[model samples]
Target: MHMEILPFTIAVPDAIIDDLHTRLTNTRWPEAELVDDWSQGAPLAYVQEVCEYWANGYDWRTRETALNRFDQFTTEIDGLDLHFIHQRSPHANATPLLLSHGWPGSIVEFHKVIEPLTDPTRFGGDAADAFHVVAPSLPGYGFSAKPTETGWGIDRIAGAFATLMSRLGYDKYVAQGGDWGAGITTALGALDPTHCQAIHVTLAMGARPKLDKELTPEMHHALERLQFYRDWDSGYSKQQATRPQTVGYGLVDSPSAQAAWIIEKFWAWTDNDGHPEDVLDRDEMLDNIMLYWINGNGASSARLYWESFGKGTRHVVTIPSGFAVFPKEISPPIREWVADSYTDIVRWQRYDKGGHFAAFEVPEVFVAEIRSMFRRYRPGF
Candidate 1:
């Protein structure tokens, strides 16, 4: 299929911003959570505080300009206009690298790491470690056109990305992701081993606990976290997977509702002591939230859960793969759990810090991990 890749720019009109302000000012807030902590949900006071700043102090223009610094474009792939940041390295032979983001995250999550990955010499890194980064906003998220039809699940999304890489003239590339991105990247590695050489993911989506295995302390802790997710942390997923449209009404209509829904996850998932702000500043978090708000992606993005949950396509990845085990991940997988699925595991590193939003929370460490893993596979290495 002939595809036309067009240059894209993000420009939210004044009217939309004004509408957002009006909504923020008029939000019908519920009473504060009865509990002192976020066990119930995003606190009323915190949501109000974030919404107030989002209206008054936050500058979308500045953030938009900063985002546009990276080369961006849109292309018709699988009947959708996919938006992506394609930052090429100054080095002549830098490897093409595809970065994927998951739910509650936009391309905003990679803003900090893009520069270092694309131009490593400038950031006090070896020229050999540079990458030509291609980070796409998934269908139904950010500026990318949402799917009006069903069946835009993980397998199809991975195929679309492979088409995207080919459209960009990249015959060989490496992939990295966490969360849904991890699942898609894994699929990419399995689907197109000819072009997609290797994959590095913080989350191994194909992994499952071995019920009969003797449990180590780490395994015990991981199972406990998994149970915790099933009991507490996964309510958002359940709701989105079942009734995305029902929730999208509130998310699209009220900026406060949208911010609270996403912000609470940041606090819960990141390696922060008390609040998400301990790791990521309000502006950084707000910038991510704005991508969802400006695009009115609440329902559209959430529908990805509905379309892919329970029913997913995860082919065993035979390509060389690497895994970064972040300590505070929702439930870090053991190599053995995924060994049957992700064969040829090349690099596995467990970090002392970082969490689900690895690139956003620890860009330096994330960059280092990518470099360390892919150095061997670089062309002519």
Candidate 2:
């Protein structure tokens, strides 16, 4: 099959920006949550403040220019234009690395880490630690064309990504991801072992609780966190999985609705003190939201959950895999829980800080951990 790759740039039309502003101005807000904390949802006041800043203070052109500094392209893969940031390293020996983003995150989450990973020497690190980074906005998210058909699940997405690596002329590569990206990366490891050599992830979606044996304190804590997620944090998941189209109406129409939808996750999932702003400033947060709003990706993105939520059959990765456990991760799965599925566990590092958005929350640590896992697997190592 002949794949056509074309250079792509982020140039949202002025009309779109104007429309967003108009929508923000005429937003019909609801009554404030009756709670003091974020237990109910993103607070009415905070959402309003962010929307006001988004309308007046945020500068899309400036952010667009910064993102355009990296080379981006779109290639037709499996009947969809897959958008990706392909930043090659100066070092001749740099290994190919594929980074995938999950829900509520676009390629914006990788902005801080891409350059550092690609050109480590510029960041005062060894060039040997460098990677030829290929960060792709997943199907139905960001600038990538959304799936019109129903079967774009994890295994299929993994296969498409493998085809992407081949088309990029990379016969071998390492992959990393978090959240839904983790599921896709795991599938890539199992399904494309011929090309995808190793995998690293923060989330292990296939992990099942060990109820037949005695549970340790770490396991107990992890289970409790899982329970908490089921009780409180998973409402969005349920809604998206069951009725994405229904929620997409609000998310696509109202900029404030989209902002609140994603911003709530940043606040709940990050290792922040009280608010998401403590970890990510308003610009950084809004930059991500614009990917959804600009593309009107609310419905398309949520449809990924509907497509693959309970249908993941790919597990038991045979390729070398690494798992980074962040302290405040939604449910920090211990090695034992995931060991059965991710068989060739090469490295499992647990950190005291950070959360689900590892790359965005702590780029330095994320870069170092990535380098550590893939260094030994580099060509001719």
Candidate 3:
């Protein structure tokens, strides 16, 4: 029972918040290169407006208080400190589900789903489907102290999560994820075929078609789009996986740069249509950015690629899996391609909406999908 939580009463210092604003106010912006479209990535007008709001109006303490409203705690697992928010349902038999997030995301991703999933009565859903939610900031992200050791790859993180479940005394549980969260959930499916039971993923990079095999029409289209994207859309990942330190310099230095980098993804991937304001409220989005900034995990968050992909790669797969393919992620995988890797088919849904940050962009959609997937395993009469 090794549990410790930072006293929720703790408040962020005014100076730190002021410093963030000061840096944002003085951002040394590059000369705007006019592009015919947003093809250059992160439009100057949009970034300037966002950075201005972040500097003048964004509130960190309010966001921190909102985050601290949950019962956040830490426990030692496998020689590392794991930070997670543990919200138990009054339903004694409520199923346990672990949700993980990816880079540029934190526990903030699930903030919208918490109330609906915890107290269904408040949200017009059935109490029978309530979950004892365990959302963890991946090692080296958010409240979890950056790992001092290496080898904490996705598989290792999956194993650590299994320990977290067992430590919480959950004998059987379902897993859910988006982005790197999806990858970790897949890793969990692979590592705990006996106990993890099932998985739900948003960023199922494993959706790749079988190698050395001809691509189907859908998959061929997906492959072509992916190739085109790699040509233009993968600089961040390549840099993160190869030289995180250099990339870290920009994010670690300026709050505006960090906001621009992260919010651009929201604009690019969401239904924003060149205006993130259309899809996300500025403060709600900045709360997420604050989680990274206040925790000083921006660099370490980027280093996940360095730590995992840097050593090598894992193309291996195992166990039953489900995919919640959103419109804005990488190319959706046809089931035929999925079957080549994960032999067990549980469920797959191609959503009409949602992008990379599935939980935040569309909580109701994700919650409904989770309930649908878990019913296959939690068939309690």
Candidate 4:
């Protein structure tokens, strides 16, 4: 089969923007949450305010222009049309790097670090540290083609990404991701070790360690946090995994539903005192929400969980791997625990700040981590 890599641009018609305004203006809002905190969900007032700003103040053209500043392209891989942003470095010998985003995140998450990673000298770093960056929107997310069948899980997604890298003429590359991106990256390391030189992941999903002895304070805390997530924080995952179509209706039809559904995760997973905006910009968060809204991927994106959540893709990764431990990550597995699954762990660093969305929350730190990890595995560091 022949695959064509076509240059792509983002140009939403005026009719779509006008329709969005009508929907936001005429939204039928619900009553405020009973509690003052966000324990229940996104506060009614908060959602209303954000939606109002989205309708009137947010400018998709500005976001579209900034996105188009980078070279974007689409290619068919494994019967799915994949969308990716490819930025080549000025340095001829720059290493190729494939960056992947997870659920509720789009290529928008990597916008902050793309230039710095691709042109390190401009960012006050050595030119040798530069990388030819390729960040792809996952299947059923953003501009990537939505899967119509039932087999588009993480394993298949990993295979598609490897095909994408090959299609782009990269024989070897490093992969980095967090959230669902982390899972797919790990899968890539396992499935395509010959081409995937190394991997850096913010979220390390390994087997649950079985300790014969007592647990340490840190281990206990990690377990408690994981349990809390399964109990309190995993409601959306369960809903999405079991009945995506049922929930996707609300998300696709009602922009407010989509915004609240995604914004709630940002608030829950980010390292923020009270609100998601404390660490993330309001417009940036809205831009991510708009990716889902405009693409009408509310249901398709959620179906990823349904496809592969418990299909047992969490196998051990043997390639040289680096794990960045963020302080406020939704699931912060201990280094000792992760070492069991990632046998060839080369680097492990714990940060005092940041959370699930490290690239978005701390681009400087994220870039530093990526460079430091690959430097260990890259030839002649």
CA error at residue 355 for candidate 1, angstroms: 0.7
TM-scores of the candidates in the order shown: 0.98, 0.98, 0.92, 0.97
Query: lDDT per residue, candidate 2, 1-381, as tens digits?
Result: 548889999999999999999999999999999999999999999999999999999999999999999999999898988999999999988999999989999999999999999999999999989899998989989999999899998888889999999999999999999998899899999999988999999987568877888998888878887889999999999999999999999999999999999999999999999999999989999999999999899999999999988887958898999999987788997898888898899999989899999999999999999999998989653
Q: Distance (Å) between predicted and true CA of 122, model 1? A: 0.5
Two-way TM-score contest, 2 vs 3, winner: 2
TM-score of 1: 0.98
On a 0 to 100 scale, what is the lDDT of residue 378 in model 2? Answer: 93
Which ranges in model 1 have alpha carbons more than 4 Å from their true place? none
Q: Which residue pairs show collisions in model 4?
A: none
Candidate 4, after superposition: displacement of residue 363 in Å? 0.7
Rank by lDDT, descending? 2, 1, 4, 3
Alpha-carbon lDDT, every model: 0.92, 0.92, 0.77, 0.89
- Candidate 4 positional error at 286, Å: 1.0
lDDT of 4 by residue, 1-381 (tens): 659999999888888889889999999999899999998999999999999999989888998898889999999988889999999999767888999899889999998999999999999998878899999999999989899788999999999999989888888899999999999999999999999999989886555755767888767766777878888899999999999999999999999999999999999999999899998988899889888988799999999989987884667889999989887888776777877678998888988899999999999999999989887555332
Query: For residues 40-66, what per-residue lDDT tens digits would candidate 1 score against the true structure?
Result: 998889889889999999998999999
Instruction: Give model 3 RMSD, 1 decimal.
Output: 2.5
